[model samples]
Target: MTGRELLRMVAAQVCVHGVMTGTRLAAPLLALQIGYSAAQVGVMLALFALSPVLLALSAGRLADKHGLRLPMHLAIGGATLGAGIAAIWPIFPVLCVSALLTGAAAATTQISMQRHVGRAAKNTSELKAVFSWMAIAPALGNFLGPLIAGVVIDHAGPEPAHEWGFRAAFAVLALMPLITLWLLRGAHEAPPEPSEEAPADRSVWDLLSVPQLRLLLLVNWMQSAAWDVHTFVVPILGHERGMSASTIGVLLGVFAAAAAAVRVVLPILSERVPEWGVVLVSTVVAACALVAYPLTPGAVSMGVCSAVLGVALGAVQPMIMSVLHQITPPNRQGEAMALRIMTLNFSSFLMPMLFGSLGAVLGVSGLFWLIGGLLVVGAPSVKGLRVDETPHERPGDPR
Candidate 1:
């Protein structure tokens, strides 16, 4: 892809991501004001993730069979409508429906864009650069989304008024994705060429049977669980700590900024260290960060811990995407990306409810400790990514 096209794609992603992240944070807060318990909050978030988990593979197949543009358009429309629904009604049941729509739309839109970028790359170098660039967009969104929502919520002040604050936040964010359509106008990326030798009946299971791909997906799930827990738990933790809504948002933003800063130099970091090494270290750092997270006595300490956790978790995505693309069949790259999304959303779907229930009994600190322990248990999965087995390079080739 040309630099201009890449920039356009990233610009579009920033808006979509902002809505996704902003809504994610805002939704729970809204539900709490609506008088939902922590377990209820988990159920609400699970419903939000349901569509994405169910539809991810099909969305990928559609992108592969047709083109990226249609899916992108559909995604933007669905997300916009979903956000508008939440803004208009501001009820738990309606918010649940909104979550489903937004989740599916965001997953499809992201898969389409990822497929487009994967198709555009000419080699390993370009793939690394593009994926790294793409990573920064989410970092920006993660920061801006909640930051904006928190300020609005804080400004609204107190219960009933702050409820309107959330409604207004969703309404404002619903419009952001419209900018994506404008940015991507006239942007064209042809689908990947068909492979004549490939069998027509190849199934997802066949793809999953690959040891490395399977291992990558599993490790990805572990890391993704860590990411989800932080997003879900932080606001609750902040609220319990007597912090304001804006401080909670800033805490999440700090994590995102640290993540973005790491991605800014990821290409260079990947060159110096193998992908496996980076992932392994990330897992350890994430474990350590999670352990420290609940121990923070105040917001500054919590922010410091968030930055550390962000750095650890942030480094994993681009590396995993680059490696996953390298390992999968060229024509099935879209499918592989969908599978990744499925894994992520599936984790997003259930982990929150599970953790929230645990937090209700064990408290937020115990929830953090449990997540940290899980990360340590899952860290060995990263070792499965042998450098020699990675596609597109020699065993000792520097990434």
Candidate 2:
């Protein structure tokens, strides 16, 4: 892919994914504003991830069969429709539906984009660089979406309730994905690999038999759980501390900005840095940050913790994607990406409710420590990871 095309892809990602990110912030805060318990909001947040768990494999197969255009169109439509529904109704049930729709759409768009970019790269260094660029999309989306939603929520209407503000935010989010369609107008879709036609008997489960992929998935899950914990718990923590919606949004936005900043330099550093080394360091740093998170006394301190955590987690995806594309078969890349999304979203779907229940008993501090402890325990396993500078697929190898 040309640099311009790559940028268009990233912009498209920001638009579609931003809609989901904004909705995630808006829905939970609205639920809380309406006097719902944190547990209830957690259930609502879980809905955002639920569709991905159920539909990721099918989405991946679609990407493999049809390439980026078809999946992108479907994803754009789903996101637009979801946000539109919530904009009109702004009810709890409709918000849940919106979450499912937007989440599934974002995940599908991500799979198609990742598969396309991975296929475009010629070597390991290029893989890392491209994915590092691609990783910026989420960070940018996360930052812009929440920052926009928060500002709109705080200022768009007479306060105490901000019902109008919430609806307005949803309407804005509903329109963001349309920009993606325009940005991708002239983008090229690469032809599918010959081996894309996998036999009907092949199962995604078979990919797990590879020990490296298995370990990578485990590490990815740990990182994903850490992310979910922060996303789900931070708003509750802020609310409990009497922080305003805009403050909480800025806090989360700061995290995303920090993440994006790290990724911006990663492409330049891709050749010099070892992917495994980056992962190991990020794992350790993320654990430390999560442990420190609940100890912060104010928004500034919490923002500091969020920035630290963002930098740690932000550096991880490019390395993971680089290793993943290298290790998985070319024809099965979409399926492999799907499998990774399924694993991460599965935890995302359940972890919020688990965090809510556990936080009520253990407190937010305990939840952070629990996840942090897991990351610490899992950090050493990164040592076992190895990536080939040039990986060749073996003929007839099931992997």
Candidate 3:
């Protein structure tokens, strides 16, 4: 794809992701507005995350067989419809259902998007650059989604009006998918290049048996958990340290901003640092930041830790995608991508509950130390990763 085409595609995908993220964030808030307990809100979030896990493989298979075009259309349509229904109904059950539908749709679209980018790449350079560019979509979406939802709800006035604000946010999110649809119009997409080495009848288990792929998943999951824990733990730690809500929010915002900044420099970094080296350095840096996070004396110190953590965590995604594509067969790239998504969503579903309980018992400080410890234990998983095996190149070749 040309630079202009890549930009247009990224813009559309980012908007759709923004809608999904916005809608996902709004659903739990809507449930809370209607008087649901925190436990119930957690359940709703779990259901949303769990939907992606259950459907990921099927979605990948569909993409591999039929290509991303039809699946993207269907997934985006479901997402749009789900948001519209939540907008029209504005009730808890409808909101839960909306979350599930949107979640499934978003997962499918992401797999398709990965496959789409994989198709566009002719070498490791393009793959790393493209995937790095794609990583910005979610970061942008995650930031925009909650910000838009919060702004709309705030503008809607006091409690009763705030309910309408949530509804309006969903309405607004629903419109983004339409823009994605428009972007899809008249745009030519490259189909994935067929691979002679990929068997036509590979099972999901077959893919998992590869040692390097398993290592990739492990590294990917560890990094994903770090990202989640940082987001979840920072506010709690900040509050414990007597920081105001706004101060903590700004700290989180800085972390996010740092992440976005790192992506801009990622292509250059990828060129110099091998993929395995990047993952190893990021893991070590993230662990160091986590150790510093709970021990920071004040907001400024904590913000510095958060920014370092964000940069470390931020550099991970594109490398994972590039390595994953390298290890899997070209034709089965969708399944490989799905496996990565499945592991991440699985982490999303389970980590919060596990860590929340741990935090309650051991305190947030203990929890941070525990995460750092776990990263230390798992450090060897990435040790086996072959940094020289650039995606789109044959094994052991120095191309």
The candidate scoring highest on TM-score is: 3
Looking at model 2, report the run of 10 residues with the lowest lDDT sum.
Answer: 389-398
lDDT of 1 by residue, 20-59 (tens): 7778788889888778998888776676578878998988
List per-candidate RMSD values in Å. 4.9, 3.4, 3.2
lDDT of each: 0.82, 0.88, 0.82
Order the candidate numbers by TM-score, best to worst.
3, 2, 1
Error of 2 at 216 (Å): 0.7
Query: Which residue pairs overlap in candidate 2's backbone?
Result: none
TM-score of each: 0.82, 0.86, 0.92
Model 1 clash pairs are none
Lowest summed lDDT over 10 consecutive residues: which window, candidate 3? 390-399
Q: Candidate 3's residue-wise lDDT over 154-271, tens digit each?
A: 6864663487788888888888888888877876767545343445556888777777888899888888888888888988888877889999999999899888889879988888
Candidate 3, number of clashes:
0
Better of 2 and 3 by lDDT: 2
- Between 1 and 2, whose lDDT is larger? 2
